[model samples]
Target: MDNNKRKLTEKELKRKNDFEKISSEMQQKGYKIKNMTINIQQANFLGPLSMLPFITLTFLFYHNVNGFDLGEISLGFVVAAILFIPLAILHELIHGVTWGFFAKNHFHSIEFGFIWSSFSPYCTCSEPLEKWQYLLGTAMPTLVLGGGTAVVSVMTNQLLLFILAEYMILSGGGDFLIILKSMLYRTDKQESVYCDHPYECGFVVFEK
Candidate 1:
């Protein structure tokens, strides 16, 4: 979809105006403001591609010690399919809850809903935040649920847990992209801000 061609709602306009005020101040301080966002549908299509290296290297690591078993792999996928719906819901809530903690208005600033285009639920935070704060929130689901489970799976040698971890990690493909973008972003002015876009999977960022 052509995101730029869509008209902004009144709320979005107000939000843009509010941020522009902050941008105005940064401009006065000799800093420039840039906006960033992502397309959910496009990102969804790229999800598996984004996860290629992690999944490849992981299986490669397991290949040295464990022989492949079709039955086990199939079971793992069945489990993943069963858990998909609940886990997907948990993923967005994870974003909302984590970001809510750092939001000025707390949970009031967080909104959740499903996206028919991406076939995924989205959690957005209206409140702006410091870079670390937003990054931490963005990383929590993949960290706590994805990385955390991956660790447990390796420690216990559980195929089910490994499957769950893999699913969770794959689910964060877009999160991984946004986090990388946010971290690589630079500013000479020593101030950076991030806010979840009102509806998109990614956030808007400013470096000042």
Candidate 2:
């Protein structure tokens, strides 16, 4: 997905104002801060767009291997639609739980809420994290619920599981965007810290 892709329309420009309140301590500690947060448009557009290949690959694999049943696919779609809300909530929780585990205050540093305007729920971690820790938390939900279920679906030949995997993977579009940006970002400095943006779909980085 990396080699020939175009740059994202949303750039992580100097968004210091967004971090002033949350990053007071990091400021005191001499961390050079930068925002990696994405806008609503990027979250709504780029996130899912990045995940298209994964979704297509999964569907094509299943279709090629097992050949979907029309009735089964219809039932799976119905069930996925009915359960999406709770599952979406779970997706955010997985981020919280995984990040919280490595946070200095544990889960106390985590917050969850919904953006009524955007129809999106968020999980935020107030503490700064090691780079790898941030990556793990960011990727956990899609790995477990999305990829794991796809494997099980293949083994069981259950179209419902595959459909559920597709929907969950789709929900991770924003997450995939965040992770991809985080990886592509470069620096000569050897150390960095990551903190989830308190109110946005992306995060901020603190570096020396």
Candidate 3:
């Protein structure tokens, strides 16, 4: 009996040590998560405005360069712009669909606004996810959107298509960074800034 008691004590000690290690790791990761969130937020403000300068520069390039066909600007640019919105919607849907494959009861949501993404793209399950599943769900959109855009851009050789892809990523804003951290967290089991309250903003909720 004494031997059995000693073994049990040893097991308990091991468990305690492991739990403490995990807890400490979580805290450190949480600090990094908060910092990343701040960076994403800061980019949200500056990135779009920075594009304005790029736009001005694009115009300057257009003007200073000779043989710029003004006719190329009209119908083709309008058609490409019209197609960009559906591509954007498909990007978000890829995120929702991939998440559903893992969490049988998964649900997702999206929000759109004039300025930013409005912060309600969500993936909720019956319980907190295994780290890998969470990471896959988070990273799905950028991969789908980015890769899709690249393939289409190559096939079409369309400059506007490439710009649309960049716009989709930039519009994702903080969420893109959140996705990156979540992907890292899968390998490292680090804490990340995930949506605590997903329904506060107007969004498209998805369910599995």
Judging by lDDT against the true structure, name the best candidate.
2
lDDT tens per residue, model 1, 1-208: 1238667656656656665665667578765556667665677778657877777665665555454567888999998999898998998899889889988899988877775644767777777788888989988998988888877777666767777888888888898888877777666766667877654457776565
Instruction: Please list the Cα RMSD from the true structure of every candidate, rounded to 1 decimal place.
Output: 3.4, 6.9, 14.5
lDDT of each: 0.75, 0.82, 0.45
Candidate that would win on TM-score: 2
**TM-score of structure candidate 2:** 0.87
Pairs that collide, model 3: 108-206
TM-score of each: 0.81, 0.87, 0.46
Clash-forming residue pairs, model 2: none
lDDT of residue 58 for candidate 2: 91
Model 3 clash number: 1
Q: Which is superior by lDDT, 1 or 2?
A: 2
Candidates in descending TM-score order: 2, 1, 3
